[model samples]
Target: MSETHALDQIAAWRAAGRKTALATVVQTWGSSPRPAGSHMAINDRNEFVGSVSGGCIEGAVVEAAREVMTSGVPKTLDFGVTNEMAWEVGLACGGKVRVFVEAVE
Candidate 1:
């Protein structure tokens, strides 16, 4: 989804008082799907907005975001989309991405 829509989701979640987290693509290597500064907003319920590594790693980001939401701690996750982990996540495309997730106050 578009970054605007993701921001809108963040606004909506905040308006509704739902616990939320924001995930951002902080670093990238090789041919990652998204570049730095890309955003994906996550809620307490695991619902999300926008793309991090396109659709390839959003689920993982959502999972990490859930942890951040629960613990009120920020997390930096690194995904080497060229390793076995990538195959597990179905990201055959090669690249590495670092996602930083922080709880939204």
Candidate 2:
């Protein structure tokens, strides 16, 4: 999904008084499915919109986003074929991605 659509989802969730977090694809290497700037917006309800890594790691990103929302602290997550989690998260495609997750006030 487009970054604009993701931002819109964040705004919608906030308007509804829901806490939200945003995960953004900041950097990518090799055969990344999505490019940098991709966004995924997750709400306190665990609902999400858009995607940072297509279908490869959205669940992991959502989990991280939940932590960011609760702690109000941003985190940068790295995933690559070299990492064991790449297989667990289904990112076995030889690519690396850096996702920055932050609570959206």
Candidate 3:
């Protein structure tokens, strides 16, 4: 989905007092599918919108978001796959991504 649409949904969720996390792709290296500023919103219910990668690493990111929700702390997470993990995660092109996960206020 488009970023604006995602942001709008987040705003609506916030208006309803839903606990939500915002994850943004702040950096990328070498052939990343998503660029900087790409975003995704995950609510307490484990629902999500937008994307930081092309599904290669979103599960990890969602797990990170869950941690942030529990700790009430925001964080920036970097994920880089080795040849083996890269193949497992499907990012076989040797790319790296930095995701900034924040608890929405």
Which one is best on TM-score? 2
Candidate 2 runs further than 4 Å off: none
Q: Best to worst by TM-score, what's the order?
A: 2, 1, 3
For residues 49-98, write the lDDT of model 3, one tens digit per residue.
88988888888778888889878899988767653446545465568888
lDDT of 2: 0.90
Q: Model 1: runs farther than 4 Å from truth?
A: 1-4, 82-84
User: Model 1: which residue pairs collide?
Assistant: none
lDDT of 1 by residue, 1-105 (tens): 467787788889999999888999999888888989999989988888788885988888888888888899899988885555666564546778888999888
Off by over 4 Å in 3: 83-90
Model 2 lowest lDDT segment of ten: 84-93
Query: TM-score of the candidate numbered 1?
Result: 0.87
Number of backbone-clashing residue pairs for each candidate, in the order shown: 0, 0, 0
- Model 2, 1-105: lDDT tens digits are 457998999999999999999999999999999999988899988899888886889999999999999999999999988877866885767889999999999
How accurate locally is residue 15 in candidate 2, as Cα lDDT from 0 to 100? Answer: 96
